[model samples]
Target: MSPPPPDRLARWLCHPHFFKVVLLLALVISAPTVAIGFYADDYVLLSYLAGRIPGSPPWYDLYNFFDGDALKLQANLVSGFPWWTDPGLKLHLVRPLASALFTLEHAVFGHAPLGYHLVSIALYVALVAAAGRLFLRVLPGATGALALFLFAVCDNHLHPVGWIACQHLLLAALPAVLGLLAYLRYREEGWRPGRYLGPLGLGVGLLGGEAALGGAAYWIAYQLAGPVPPGRAAGLRARAAAALPALGLLAYFAAYKAVGGGAANTGGYVDPLASPLRFAAAAAERLPVLLGDALVSMPADLTSALPSGPFVAVGLAAVAGLALLYRACLPAIPERERAALRWLVPGALLALVTSLGGFPGSRLLLLPSLGIAPLLAVVILRGLRRGPSPGRAAWPRRAGAGLLAAVHVAIAPLLFLAATASSADIARKLEGVARTAELGAPPRERAFIAAASDPMVTIYPQAILGLASPDALPCWSALSMARASHRLTRTGPSSFTLEPLGRTMLTGAFETLYRAPSAPIPRGYQVTQCGATIRVAEVEDGKPSRLEVDLGAPLEDPGLALLSWRDGRLRRMALPAIGEAVELPWSPGPIGLL
Candidate 1:
């Protein structure tokens, strides 16, 4: 009998011939990441490598604008800790392999951003290609094909691909991917070829990074998922062998943490000895979100800003594609493969929950996809087939699957566009900060870098060094200034007090005071180099507000100007000096050139 329309359509779409097209699209979609500049934590990496962080000059009370009063960055420096004794570095979490890769890149590429982007893309592309092939091997027929396509296209969790600091996820995940592949081979080809390779992959993955360790659960899940052998003794032996990797990983983590091995434990982990309940609660809460982000394309971080019209299109497409592909792919999967998901599901859950002691970001989701991807494939197959012997899928079920699949397929491309836009946005902002530094920064030691154009709450390196160089580096950054933001005004104009927040000195050539005001100030309240501040009352809320009040003599006569930093471009307010009022009648405050 001729196959039904949906089944025929699925076969064509899931064909192996189409995989090359998906691979090509993956490359194209990810290429724009080259445009992204080094941002935030990327600078932290540079700072540490330069040895500026570990050995900050005694004179610097609080180093850099990014390092607040606490000297948190200074503490995480890997220099002081001996690896054999104390594995943890104060400033960073320990991921030796990932760190080594970044160091190697820097040695080769230096400050060039494009080189790092390319390297990451190359590695990720290879990983994706492997994933697609692996899916084809395990699941039967078109199910594997469809799953491979899904693996290639779906990259909503792409932090590792874009961010320099997040490459650990990719590094750790690669080994796990290898392990899964080797396990599949072992299941098919028996002892000699697959036995040693599978466990070796898993064990290496454990030491590579914490994300790598999540694969143990996947190993367990894979072994027990299918039909069991006739002998209980055989099953027990198989399970025991599978358990070795997980046990080794546990032993490694215990030893690593005991000596204070550096780990990415920001709010995610508390010392079990110190507070077990807190750790347990955090893991419990994070488990659901982690699974949700992996299986569902509904992560709030990336999607909140998405336009409604496109989102609806994405949603409708997913519903339709999933519906159609589910029917096409389901029957093809062997019953044994379907059982594999039982282990895959729990493995993914355990991997995420156990790995993070604190909150997990979507960037960390890439590793979990190893187990989740296979599990999701199994789910898709089961939902479509519905039973041991299947007839034509119901209309409602087909429609549902098609829509879901379409959303997944469509969103991948859309997310690629969004990531590109985000990278461009970061570059643009970095440029604006650079411009501001060129015009205003002084060739001096200390600088008061009030965060005038902050997209997020914390100050970034872009605000301080203009995204390049430490005093030690060959090239000096914009303004060639070491920026500090001593606490400034809060509340209203009356409550405003311009003074150093902590012990950190604002004694450089310029003491810039940045402010984001609630209400508009009357004329002459603050200086603006750009225009008359009298009408500065026209300034709106949540906008960047800067007033340049020149210090004629220490706290004496003041000259005024206004600076507006918007749209990743800056307009310097160079209004010739009007006498300064140290206190404003509610001025956004004066920002002086150092």
Candidate 2:
């Protein structure tokens, strides 16, 4: 029943058990989709990319956010970014190939919620299946199976995998894992020119999710740590050929910089000005959070059940467990993969340290978990390898293995259900707001809509649909309005605001332009369907100027004034009549409700 060497991959990927596990995990983890719908970012990004909204993000719009001279009303326009739309910031493009996936998907799915959801699920299963084969090949018997099952049922993945907009992570990860698996296969057989395809896929996958870059890192580490096979000279030559694509990527980055791609702001973490101690401390503080998020649940998710004192203890203990497992299993591991253990350290570092930069969400942990899963599987398999021999010690080892397996089996499904439940909760709230946008979306200028409950869902509550295109009257989030009030004080409305936040205030759907902040102010600011800034309240000695200007209501436009009120709250003001103008006193900061 043993699979042939070449057929090894097929055995894991095509096995009946893989299918069964995928089905069960899908039912458990994605059961929430029954109630789940498009969420905050999904409505905006998907619609725009699919050109379902006015002022859609054209191809290469990500960089346009940085391009000062880029087209007007481009959703991502950055009029005056301090960094000048640095190329490092748009690192998202490394996975630009993923956009093609979305394009094809929407062509078939046509933005149907069911279609997007199913596609997302299918990609998730595909990623886990590919990862399962790689782990099975690398790790000892039965280890990759358990690790893959845990990966399928992994708690953190629910948010990233279940959410459609977040499917980029899945798309990026699949190719990365595939590339690494292909590298391993080539390492076993002789490397050929076709092996170069592995690196090419990796390069594309990197753009999908930067975490996929780990696949390239892994290949490098494998060559370094793995013992050279016979014909070492020729073997490395073949690998060198495969490595050319990655080298070309590096060359591309160098060329990218030559083209004015802004330098990465490593100053925050890696700068000489930054205190090394503080950097490590900050990274340290985040490490536990990343670990906790990956190993169990987020602090927010566990706050009530697990108190701060015990939470730290559990987090540390979890860390301690890994260290101990590595020490215990270091001896039994096959020598070739034994050196490969070093990969786990960086992998853990990557998973844990990434938290220092961004918000500590489970999404951040997905890539690191990909690394962590194999390491954990190796240790578990290593321990089982030593135990359950045919002797007095056999029962003890068998009992231990059974207990460990039972815990993984039981906890996996529970974590999956918990992930689905958490998703369901967020979905319920977003559904009401999405419905509002679809039904009550306004059709004219000088208008804003209050979100049902979520503060982050910006723009109108509705998206208008036509046979070929979609349109809605311009709108504002509270943040957008505050930004408008602040920018009008200096740059005036219609001119591109030089600052980044001010830049977002200008949605590209409508035409508007402004002079620089230092330039002369216009008579008044006006955007056709959106509202305009009429005047700025001058402030001297920090006292409020409270300037007054009239915002005329358009006959066809919704006569709502977007205002920022006390405690950073935002609300809309209604005009008495369509032709009436609201003359209001305003300060330099965000304006408030009348």
Residues 360-384 of candidate 1: C-alpha lDDT, one tens digit per residue: 4566666667656665555454454
Counting only residues 3 or more apart in sequence or on different chains, how many pairs clash (N, Cα, C under 3 Å) in candidate 2?
Answer: 15
Please give me the total number of clashing residue pairs in predicted model 1. Answer: 49
Q: Which stretches of candidate 1 lie over 4 Å from their true place?
A: 13-16, 54-91, 224-241, 262-275, 300-334, 378-395, 437-439, 449-458, 462-594
Off by over 4 Å in 2: 1-35, 50-55, 59-94, 191-194, 231-245, 252-288, 299-317, 328-340, 344-360, 380-409, 434-444, 448-455, 459-471, 479-558, 561-594
Q: Provide the lowest-lDDT 10-residue window in model 1.
A: 80-89
Candidate 1 lDDT for residue 368: 65
| lDDT for predicted candidate 1 compared with the true structure | 0.49
User: What is the Cα-based TM-score of model 1?
Assistant: 0.67
